[model samples]
Target: MSEPIRVCVTGAAGQIAYSLLYMIANGDVFGREQKVILTLLDIEPMMGVLEGVVMELSDCAFTLLTQVIPTADPAVAFKDVSVAFLVGAMPRRQGMERKDLLSANVKIFKVQGEALNTYAKKDVKVLVVGNPANTNALICSHYAPTIPKENFTAMTRLDQNRARAQIAQRVGTDISNVQNIIIWGNHSATQFPDVANGTANGKAITDLVDTSYLQSEFIETVQKRGAAVIAARKMSSAMSAAKAAADHVRDWWLGTTGTFVSMGVLSDGSYNIPKDIVFSFPVEIQNKQWKIVQGLNIDEFARGKLDITTKELLEEKEEAMAICNAN
Candidate 1:
């Protein structure tokens, strides 16, 4: 058995962490053979709630959970951590614009980023799960100047999973049948869930479904699925978001098998997206490192979609940068 590792999850008292903790404790992420020390961090006011969550974790009798560190201090939570799930940030409230959320989250991430830089492992893999995630991640990386830009990523896997499910439901096949469904650009409604290169059961998705459906309904549904969930449930997606975060870490750690997966990695000028802003792209993982898949043909329509989403990210990046520069 390998040495035990520390995993940190911020916003430990929140609904998503409530669902996510069990997944990590059960060894769904790092293999069942590996032991994990969970560092659950929330604000000072929420430590009482975190204590209850820790009690529940203790009762689960998971062999892989060797220790649980519950603290309000970023220093304690981030110290020597191997994998950090940055789930703690101010959520968008009623009638809040993206810029408002960006302003709030940038400050939170700046502190966490500094913590990661000062205390975390040099190679710590960070995933930003909060809203305005891509910009938050960019700002986080900006603060942690020593950490590699590739180490920070935002969660667009949720959107990717939704796209796959919609494709499967429409094509009358299992979700696993759809591979390489790319979520281009941001995590918001402007995100373009491109299926141009995706294959369903070794056949082209465009061939399996009508071009019109893929172009119109498929794009709109995947883009607005989160809002639909919020509308129906009166709460944002928690369990599904947790599951996607796990999938992302699992794939990133263990390496991808057959097809490329969607991830919001820092843009490297791929597909004409400007560098610095984290943008979702079709990526393949190998040796615990993710690289954007290259050389896929982008038709005019896909180019237009990418440009639209890139515009949103650029604006978001501007807002986040302004906050960082001020503070």
Candidate 2:
């Protein structure tokens, strides 16, 4: 058999990983034909939890699974991995300010990033799934200087999926038919879910939906969908999040043709976004590399929404950098 690809998942014992690990092992990200070696990472205290998770995986006896390595050490987790899901981060506790959450996660990502730089394969493709994901991705790439910035991305695919579903429901079409929805800016509530250039079954979304709904209800629903899940379930969205995370890396690994997906990649001054911060944009993947989709006209309404999200991202950048500099 060919050598199995090494894949690492941080926060492997968490709720998200509980669902994600199976998908990775059972050919959700990599193709079913591709063999995989899974490396799972969690804090020392969560090692017990990971043991049960591993046991379940073992019972499944996946034909494509080659190995599973569970560890608390980042260096051990990252070493030689070809693909990484940086899913672990300090969760926001009650009474914690936004800055506090950012600060804690910044420290965690810095350590993991440094480990990734020192041990992970040079070409490792990383997806940041933790909250404050775009800024966390920035901090991770900042510490992992050897890994090209393009290799680090934040998960905005969840937002994109939500937007597509909403558009599909309103227009009464299969969600698959909705294309070109863009989740612009941060992974936070300030992110803009844009359908300005989107189409549903070869027809413009604008032509089907009035501007009032598009400008208000549709935008807010996608942006606040996470909160809605939390309010109803009394916990965050895990199953859907894990699914989206898997879909994200799967698309990135295999590459997408004739369509684009939303990903938070490092900005290179594209579409008036400032350079170096991780901003979500509509991107097309080819040959395992992604290029941001260009030439979509940003009208006045779209430009204003973009600016709002951009401001939030810049504020997030400043806050994260301040915390990093202090440490």
Candidate 3:
């Protein structure tokens, strides 16, 4: 067998981690043929919880899992890591200001960026799943000058998947038939789920669904799905979010030759999005890096919603920059 791939996941004590670890161990992300060495990283206070998670992994006896290492040290956890999933963050409390949240996460990602630069594999691909994920990914990518900017991405596949499921339900078709749904701009409430270019079993989505319904109801549902989940479950989305994270990385590392997914990445001026903002776009993975799918015509409606979501991303970037400058 080839040498095992090293994968590091931060925030191993959290709910998403709880859902993600078993999946990773069972080869749900990397495939059964690829042996994996797993590193679980968390704060000192959560070390015990991480150990418990490790114990559970041990019980599974996963043949593809070579070893499991739990650590509180970034350098140790990220050492030689091929894939880094940054999931830990200071979540926004009921009244927490954007500045406060940004400042706190900046410190966390800065240290992680430095550690990644120093210890991860030369080709390490990072996916930030924390809240304000796009901005937090920008912080890490900006700080890690050694890592190619294209190697850093934030999770928007969740939004894309959610859009696909919603469209499938409305069309009374299996989700397998839904294709080309694009989630534009950001991962938050302002995210634009564009079905203008999407299709259900090769039929244009716009032809099947009312354009107004797609623009208003469908878009809003995809954008606010996270909040809706939280409201209903009384907890942040964990299982589905974990699955999305896995799918994002799996498609990235494994390649998306004929498929497209959404990822929040440093913009290259696609769709007139301001450069350097980590915004979601339709992308395909090749050679373990995301290349934004360009030249898609954006209609007036799609363009308007894209602008709205991109503006939200830009504002978040500004908030992060302000906090960094203030400190």
Candidate 4:
């Protein structure tokens, strides 16, 4: 048999890690044909939890899983890694400033980036799933100057999937029928889920549903879905988030040649988004890299919303830069 593909996940003791590890071991993300060796990375305090997770993986008796290694050090965890998921982050507490959150994450990402640059395989692909994912991804890409910018992306696929599911429910149709829905701009509250271009079973979403209702209520629903889940369950979103992260990376590496999906990628000034800032946009993955779906004609309304989301990304990028420079 050939060598197993190495997959490294940071923040392995967190809730999402719990959901993600099983799926990976079962070949949910990388496929059954691909044998995997899992590397779980976490902080020193969480190393014990990671060990427990590894024990569970061993119990599953998954033949496709070659090995599981848990570590607190990025250098060791990322060594020869084929894929890296940056999932551990400092969650923003109530009353904490956004600047503080950004700064804290920057410190973490900077170290990871340097480690990845020095240790990971040349073909390693990175997905940032932590909060302020776009900005965090930018920091990593910037620090790893030799890695291609297209190799670093943040997870906005969750937001995209959320929008699709909400639209499907509203239309009384299955999610598989939904297409062309775009998650524009930041992955945060400012994300613009453009159903204007979306279709359900070849029917325009706007034509089937009330455009005004979608613009007002539907958008808010998709944006606040995370909060709603937290309110109901008294916990952060983990399972769905993990699933989305898996989908994001799977589609990226596996290729979305004909289909478009949303991802936060380093901007090349597409749609006037500032260069180097990781912003969400409709993209198609080909040739092992993400290429923004360019040349789409944006109406006035879409343009306005897109600008709002891009502005937030730009502000966050500036904040991170300022904090890094000051320190």
Which pairs in model 4 have colliding backbones? Answer: none
* lDDT (C-alpha, whole model) for all candidates: 0.93, 0.93, 0.89, 0.89
Query: Which portions of model 1 miss their true places by more than 4 Å?
Result: none
Q: Candidate 1 has what TM-score?
A: 0.98
For candidate 3, the lDDT comes to: 0.89
Tens digit per residue, CA lDDT, model 2, 1-327: 557999999999999998898999999889988899999999999999999999999999999998999999988999899999988888888899989999999989999999999999999999999989999999999999999999999999999999999999999999989998899999988888988889999999999999999999998999899889999999889889999999999999999978879999999998999998899999999888999999889888888888988998898899999999999
lDDT of 4 at 252: 80
Model 3 CA lDDT for position 54? 89
Q: How many backbone clashes does candidate 4 have?
A: 0
RMSD of each: 0.9, 0.9, 1.1, 1.2
Quality of model 2 by C-alpha lDDT? 0.93
- The C-alpha stretches of model 2 lying farther than 4 A from their native spots are none
TM-score, prediction 3: 0.97
Per-residue lDDT of model 3, residues 1-327, tens digit only: 667999999998899999988888788888778899999999999998888898989998989899999999999999999999999988999899888888899999989999999999878989999988999999988678898988889999899999999999999999999998988888888888888778998899999999788978898899899999999999988999999999999888788867678999899887788999999999988877678898899888778888888878888889888776676
- Candidate 4 lDDT tens digits, 73-151: 8898999999998999989999999999999999999999999999999789999999989999998887788788888
TM-score of each: 0.98, 0.98, 0.97, 0.97
Q: Give the per-residue lDDT of model 1 (tens digit) for 9-58.
A: 99999999999999999999998999999999999999999999999999
Instruction: List the candidate 3 regions with Cα displacement exceeding 4 Å.
Output: none
Between prediction 1 and prediction 3, which has the larger lDDT?
A: 1
